[model samples]
Target: MAADVRLSSLKEWDDDQVLSAMSEGNRLALAELYERYWYVLYRVAFQKTKSSEMAEELVQDLFVQLWQKRASLTVRRVDSYLFGALKYSVIDSIKSRIVHEKFQEYQQFFAPQVDSSTEDQLAYSDLLGTIETELLKLPPKTQEVFRMSRFEGQTIPEISQKLALTDKAVEYHLSKALKLLRTQLRDYSFVWLLISFGQL
Candidate 1:
């Protein structure tokens, strides 16, 4: 039992040591620290989002953001800092949903002034609907890759492990899938390009 306790303590020190190196701007250390917590962060976000799909994305995005800002990040406790970021990211997602709802309501209020050109509006809406349908029609693995990279914000290596694919394979699949989507939706609007930046 004492040995077990000692082992646990040593495991904790391992995490802290990696974190110390990370704070000193070690990319490899940061990657190790993130991999250690990736699943935990995913679970926390998944619990909040109540969707395995969205949770995966949230975890990915948080780590990407963390990596991008690692040089400036300082934390007294790595676990607490990660969970705090997860909470904030989830809250931000909820707020976005609320804002979207409000915007939809506002649009409904002004429905009378909507463009009366049914042909054009229908065509545009149909195109959007078609794109969404096609996206959903993709293989489950492809969808997961898209969600992890674009929405959750994970790196290629991370996604590769999560889905049990090689990093090179992940990159190829993502590239091909993204190319198809962009080509199909390119004529719609450039705003979808921005959606690739963060979660909706």
Candidate 2:
């Protein structure tokens, strides 16, 4: 009886509970997460993209992809994960439109969470450069997975279908590439800004 009561009480559910529900195709759980973070995500995206329409679009797209990839994703902290994903979405949106100087200003997105040193000019250049450079050093399969997942914005299922591998295998290669980037780019403080939510 108590368990049944708890099951009906979504407001009492933690992130893990919500995610577990999501894994089982629970639309209500997805709605809970969306209601919890969509506004915050939109605000962050708006600050970076400077466009309300763009911000709403990125946040909406993120939720859509989150639903699409829920089974394959290994998210420990939901809010942190959403913020990180939104950062990449904002970058992808602005990547082709902005010059290097304007691009550096995008550091404002991470400035409050990350330190000031990472905002330095050299670090700014290396931040984007390092992502591309380290991306090239991975094994061929890992490289393809990283590009498809990160640069191309494909979900794990999509990559698995395209690459003829299981979703787990695709996730493994994607994780490997990100871990490698995090380790190899540890020197650049800017890299740390993206790799983890908390301290380096």
Decoy 1 TM-score against native = 0.47
- Candidate 1, 115-135: lDDT as tens digits: 567775676567657657767
lDDT values of the candidates?
Answer: 0.67, 0.72
What's the distance in Å from true for residue 13, model 1?
5.6
Backbone clash pairs in model 1 (N, Cα, C under 3 Å; residues 3+ apart or in different chains), count = 5
Winning candidate number (lDDT): 2
Q: Which residue ranges in model 1 land beyond 4 Å of their true spot?
A: 1-13, 113-200
lDDT for residue 183 in candidate 2, whole number 0-100: 83
Alpha carbon deviation, residue 123, candidate 2 (Å) = 41
RMSD to truth, every model: 10.4, 12.5
Clashes of 2: 0
